[model samples]
Structures are given as C-alpha cells and as structure tokens.
Target: MAEDRRKEIVRHLSEDDLDRLLAETDDDKISKRLTFVKRLYKGATLEDAADDVGRSSGTATRWARRWNEGGLGLLTPNFGGGRPPKLDEDEQDELIERLRDGQPWKSQEVQHLLSEKFDAEYHPHYLGTFLRDLGLSYAKPRPKRPHQPENPDEILEERVDDALDEDDQPHNKRAGDDGEGWVVDEDVCTDGGTVIGFFDASQPQPYDNSRRVWYVDDPHVERPLVKTEDSAVGFYAPNGESLVTFTEDETKERICEVLELIREQNPGKRILLVLDKHGSHIYEYTRKRAHQLGIDLIFLPSGSPHLNPIEKVWDYLKWTMCPIIVENEGEFKILVKDVFERITRRISYAQSWCEKFLDLQKLS
Candidate 1:
C-alpha cells in the first residue's frame, strides 16, 4: 500500500518541474522524499508507498515521520547558494587600513577595485552588505580636541556658596565700612532728533518747574530730524522739556545740565548719579563737572541698555505719540509739545511705569 502511495505521488508531479528539480544533483533525495510524502497524504499504505518509490521500508517510515511532524515543509529543500568569501583575515586588515588612511572605499569604489584588482564582478549593494558583515560602516570623521579640567564634585556646594556670598556683598565698599550704602538711579538720553518731553520721578510736579524740565522746552523741539544714523526722531530725552541729540559733545552738555540742576535744587545734599555707560557721559569734562558739583557718578555695566530709566520713558513716549505726523516743522513741534503736556498731566502713570521698571530690574 505504501509503495502504491509513493507511485501515485510521483505521477502527480509536473514532468518539466520534476526535470528541473532533478538537474540539481544535491536536491534529488529531498525531491524523492517530497513525492513519497504527497502519496502518504493521499491515503496509500506506508509499506506499498516505500516499495513503489524504490525506497527501503526504513526510508519510507522516516518520510512518514517527517510528514506527520511538520507536514509538506519537512520534505522541501533549502537552497542557500553563494561562493565562500574571497577576502580572508589579511585582506580584511588591509581594507580597514586603507579606509583609515582616508581612502574612499564606498560600495561602488570597492566594486570598481574588485573588478580592476581581483577581476571579480560585484554589485555595489552586495559589496555594502559584505562590508557591513565585517563590522564596517560609513561614518563622518571627527577631529579631537584638548581635554578640559574636570569639575570637582566634592567642592560644588562650597563653590556655589562662595558665589552667593560674593553676590550678596555691596558692589562698592568704603574703607572700614560695615553698612551698605544706597545706589542712586539716573538716566541719560543720547539721541537728539527732536524734543519730545521728559518725566522726572524725583520731582512730583516736573511741569511746575520754572525752567523747562524736559525735551519740550528745547528751541529745536519741532524739527523731526534723525539724531544719529542709529537713532529715530526724539530718541533721547535729557530734561523735562528738552530732547538733547546724541553726540559726544551733546551728551557732555546734557550731563553738565543735569548736574547743574541737581546742584541748584539741593545746594547742600551730596548726590549720587547713576547713569548708563555712554562714552560722552563718562568723559573727562562730564566727570570733572560731576566732581565739581560734589556729585558721585556711578555708571551701569556695559550692554545693559534697559538698566536706564530714561529708556522706559522713551518707550512710553513712542507708544503714545508714534504715528504723529505734521505738515511743517512748526506743526510737528506743537504736536510734540502737546504730547509733553499730556505726559505732565499723567504724572501718576509715569510714576507707576517707573516703579514697575525698577521692580523688573530687581527681579532680573
């Protein structure tokens, strides 16, 4: 019965496909086993199937065992074809050295090299897989840099405490002084395009001053000219009614004017003037004037433009008075003057803005 089953399986095979399978000598036994298994599935007895396929009873039993265990797949042959690698240990080392020396051996380059040097035709993709199997990969070359000092973990807390202590100390300390002195704040406007207006937090009523207290008082208040290439019209306000243009010479004059006003107002009081670090404000003439008037001038650190209160006032003016257009210089002057009048009336708002700015600086 098994021999009959095996013959039936062989009869079902396509002649052309069977002939192709027979062409691979190594796969013949596996193909014969597949024919036996097919016959067994069709209900032939094991012994008859074995005889019909010219196999011994033991061979038929083995094929039956494989079919019962794994079905038709057990009778199929695996075809893994390719030549063994030609590049051995020494060749691998040479390839790595060439790559390390900055020679480009990309898959295409390697393929070209193989054809030229070893007379082997290789696909670029195949060569790439070969290189990958050898633990090689395409990567960017990185340059090395000098080592830096390592952070000392144990001293981190102590270093941080020292920094905090240094920051807490007063910036300027007098000899043998234990108490921290006060820091006065002052703002200097350097751009002079037009006279807008000014707000003095130090004065409750800046408009009530006999002399013009802001940019609005300047004779050239109406002309909307650019003070400097970097500035727009009315960029800096020096006095309550004066828009002083930004110039080394003009800055010196404004500083002198502020010093004069401080001197005139507080005849006996020693004043500390805090100003932005503009070159003209720190010039010899300005310094001498401050010294002569018994004014101590302290400047804000460089690049800290927002530290100056005048900048805040300028921002307010720009927001409230921008888009202010005039047909003539006189008309422009009148508009600017009106803006100052409005600012003078809004002293409370000015004070609120100034206080908020100072609070922000403290937090920063």
Candidate 2:
C-alpha cells in the first residue's frame, strides 16, 4: 500500500455524457456508476463517493479504474460486459415463443434443451440471472395433479372425527396399540356378524406400476410393457380384507355388483362398506341398490386417500406383486386371486393398516 499510488478518475465525462447520466431513467446499476463518478468529480474521496451513491468502496474503485482506462466511453452499458450471450436476439425470441406455447421447464431441463437443440451451453448460476432478466419468477408447485380432490386440513380432521364417532371409540388412544379392532354392531350379532371393510378400484398394468424399480445403473435398459387387448379393473380393499370382484369396466353397475357380493358374503348382519367417493359409488342407481340390500356405504373424505387404510394394499399390489406377474393377462388374474386370498387370510396385515387411521383420531 504505497501512499503516493492512490487511484482516481483520470478523465472527465463530456457535457453530453454528463447530461445523459443525469437524465437517464433506466438501469439502476448504470445510474449508480455515474453518480459515483459525479460525486468523485466534486472532490469527494472514494469512501465519500460510495456513501453518496449508495455503493461500496470496491464498486467506486472499479468505476474509477474503468473510466480512467477508456474515458466516458467505458461507462456505456456494453463496455467491458462479460461474455456475449449464446442465444442471439432472434434465437432468444424463438425460445420465448416456444416457452409461451404452454409447457413448464425446470432450469436444468431448459439448459439441456438449449444445449441439444441450439448448441448453446450456459453455467447453471448464469441461468438464474437470465431467467430473472426475462421477467420470469419462481412459481410454487401445484398442491395436487389434475382431477385430484381439493381438501383442506380441516376436512381430514372432520373425517377422523366422523370415523371415531361411528366406531364409538374414546378420544384418547395410543397409535401403535392392538386395541384398534373392527368391532361390529353388538346388536347385529353375537357369534358372527357383518364386518367393516375398505374398498377401492385398481388396474394391474404390465409395466412397472411405479416410477421407480430395482435395476442396475443402465440407462439403455428399457422398461418392458405388456400390451394387453383390454384393461382389468379390480374392486377391493386397498390393504385389507374385502370380497374383491373383477370387471372390464369400472361402472356403476359393477360397483353395485360388488355391494351385492359383500351383502351375500355376510348374510347374518348388515355390511358396512368404507369406500372413496368415486362417481360410480355415489350414482343414484348404485345408492338405491345398496339401500335395498343390507349394505351401508361410508365415503371417505375427498382427496384423502391417506385416511383410507386400504391405500397401502394397492401400493403393495402394484409395486410388489404387479412387477412379477407379467407373463400374460391370465397369469396376472391368477396372481391377483392368489395374493387376494393370502391377504384376506392374514388378517393382521389389514388390521395393522386399519389401526393407523383409528389412532389418527387421537392425533393432536
């Protein structure tokens, strides 16, 4: 640090440049730079100039160095600007047009698209600045996908209340306790009676039922798809015991059949069916038929599949069983039947799933 080597602005701005600096209304950064120079020209120290222009001493020093090296010309917006953009004006216009055509693009995805299509590569950090300059801001992610039910936390809380009241359970109960029993109405029967059951519709596809799979790190290993002539819709509990029925189409009539089957299975008492509010389940014809038989339907809260214990069963079936039973449609049906029997026989599995929701009532 030599005392005699103090840096200063060596050239004065022309009258026109001074006028433009004062009159210019855009580009705050450029305005700050001009103000720093103007303050320094008024015999202010670098520190004083920085304070007057609301910039740091380092910024003032850089502005002085640029002005000293290239006179007033260096103060222009383009002077010593970093690298030129990869996308030209025309290319940028095309990119904006493509983006406006209604598709969401993550920054990395956009980077890849530009690299592959336009042969333009950008540092990930610069991409943020580029997007901000283009007048784009980060958007909050959607809460649910299309056709998904819109429910508030209070709605789920209400369902828990209703479920607890229906079962006549006390408000306080431990979550992991074995006391969560599917008790039938005592007045209905003494030795045997109709049972509570969860029900949902599922389709077993040949491909991986989930987005993920157990595989070696190989991008080229394509996922296999079983191109069946028709799809099969299964009506049963998600993770519990139910009288499952298969149909080519999941219709109001098919759901009514399921209800009748449930009623027939438990002949002595009225069957209590816990199911989602699917259109088929709530149709006029389906409800009337259910009422005629000794079948009671309890619809779960909208958009709250988590509240349904049987959701776990569908997850187990698709991710665990569907992957292996891929020989043909016949084999798939056989696999479903085998798994269904095993699930129904092992009552503890379904009970454990049911217990979770039972304890949800006790949750604060």
Candidate 3:
C-alpha cells in the first residue's frame, strides 16, 4: 500500500502543487524535474517518467527521494563529487615508473615511498589493488647465476650433432685409440645406428624429503640427518631404456665402469652420451675408456643445466622418493634406487629434450 501510494504522484507534492511549481519555475533544472512528476501523476511509470525528462530511472528515484525528504532544496546539486584520489594522473604515472626501477618493493616500503615523495597515503590492503591497477604484480624473484658459452644451445647442438653423425667413409684407427684399434663404426663418428643417452648425476642427502604433507593433527615427516650423501648417476633414453647406478661417491673409476656397463648392455649400437663437463666424466682416463668402448661423449656448456633433460629426471626421482619413510642412509639409498627404477619405467621424461635437440629420424 505504501509503495502504491508513493508511486501514484510522487510523495509530498500533489497534482496542484506540481502545476503551480511548473508555472512559476524559472530554473530549467527544477522545471525539468516538475515535468517528470507531472508524467508520473498521469500514469507514466518511473522508467517512462525518467525517459520524458531525459534522466535515468535511478536518477528519477533519487530526485523523488530528495523531493520527499527536503522538497526542492536538497536535490539542487551535489557539489561534493567523491573522495579525491591520493595521487593525480601525472603523479600516478610517475609512481609506476618509480616502482618499475628493477627493485622489488614491499607494501610497507611502497607506502613509505608514496608518503615520502608525493605526501600521499594508502592503506596496505588497498595498495595491492592500486599496484595491480598500475600494471604491476607481486612475485618472489629468484637469483640466477651467470654461465659461459653465451650461445649454449648452438654449442650443445653442434656437439651432439657431431657425436650422432655417421661419417660417409671410415678412417683408420688412431695410433692411441686406447691401444685396442677403435672399432671403425664405433668411433665418435660412425656408420652404425646412433643410440643417444642423456646422462646426469645427483647426490640426494639423507636429510632430503618432501617439505609439505597433508596430515591429520600434524604428522612429523622426517629424514635422517647424515654426514654422507648418496650419488646416483643416471643415463636416460627416449626409447624408454634407462640406466641408473647408485654409488656412495662418484669417481672417474665409477664413470668408466658405468661406461663399460652401458656398452655391455647396448651391444653394437653406436652410443652417443650427452653429459655435463664434470671432473669425473671429463678425466683423460674416462675419455680414453669411452673411446675404447666406442661410445661418443658430448659435453654440455658450463653452468647450463637447463639444457640437459636428465636433471629433470633426477628431480622427479627425488620428489617421488621424498614422501616415503626411511630410517638411515642405508635405507635411504635403497629407497632412492627403488624410486628411480619406477620413474624410469616411463619414457615421457626424455621426449621434450629429444624434440628440441635431436633428429630421431637420422639415427641410422
């Protein structure tokens, strides 16, 4: 009933009063509103009334409310626009430039800078939205150590290509080719089919384990704090055949042994091993052993671990094993080997590396 009464002819003003105001009004603004009230009194809706006066329904409602509350005086004009921005447009652009000066900024620090420079203040919660509005995002920056061989991809690709290439003609066995007269097809460049292997060694300490856990009432996920580390030297292939050796320590002798082991496993295929320039693998004896075994070695550029897919394999292995419980270093080593075997069962790990750096169609 009250809504019906208010809708009839607007409130407080009667039909006669509106006619009187419309006749005597000299103000264009007040006269426009008087015409709107007359439309409502003659059966037009709030929407139709707004359309008659070239105003929105919401604006008509505000005008009607103001007219009911304090008559004409209250609806004249709202001079107070809104809370002014702490910083003007030019000042905002300057603040954005200052924020992007390559230095990470904290909320409190930004607040201080604003107060110090522009004499402006913002609450910390609102500042996040302000920074985002200014085209900035929050993130933790990681430190990246610089490395050598500026063109690492080109350098590495060239080496791997050389290793995988099969020479058109065979050359005589070199005088010092391990004193065993190198297998002509077995040399770094060979006519035999090439078997590419990405190799890396990871030392997961006894204290290494998953940092996060889903638990009820707090489960104490723990690992033994031991002084010794376990070394895992791994060779992964795209065809899903992988080899991982667990050792107390990685040494040149162990590397040569692993090479012999791989040769024994792979038989007559021309082996091309892609590995980092580690001391053990690059030692003269190790190179001689590789040549003797007819396995070609391609070294990745220094400090460029991202180029090798084997590092991801190691990370996956550690992550897979990190959740399980193990008591001592002996137990940890066993668990590590078991987890590695399971992870290597799937060949998906090497697919990305091969697609980026290898021509699998040229294996023969």
Per-candidate Cα lDDT values, in order, are: 0.46, 0.60, 0.70
Sort all candidates by lDDT, best to worst. 3, 2, 1
Better of 1 and 2 by TM-score: 2
TM-score of each: 0.29, 0.45, 0.64
- Evaluated with lDDT, which candidate comes out highest? 3
Cα lDDT tens digits for candidate 1, 1-364:
3333332233434545445655654765566765565556566677766666776654555556555556545545354556655763346555555555766455677777666755666566677666654446677744332321233222322322332232433323334543432332344322222111221221111111233324655643444432212122221223233332222234567657755665554444444444554676667666666655555454544454344445565556555544444465445445554664465445433353234322332222
lDDT computed for candidate 2: 0.60
Model 2 TM-score is 0.45
Indicate whether candidate 1 or candidate 2 has the larger lDDT.
2
- Model 2 stretches with alpha carbons more than 4 Å out: 1-105, 108-122, 125-194, 209-241, 325-327, 343-364
In model 1, the runs with Cα more than 4 Å from the true position are 1-254, 261-270, 330-364
Candidate 3 lDDT at 353 equals 75
Best by TM-score: 3
Pairs that clash in candidate 2: 238-310, 238-313, 239-310
Q: What lDDT does model 3 reach?
A: 0.70
lDDT against true structure, model 1: 0.46
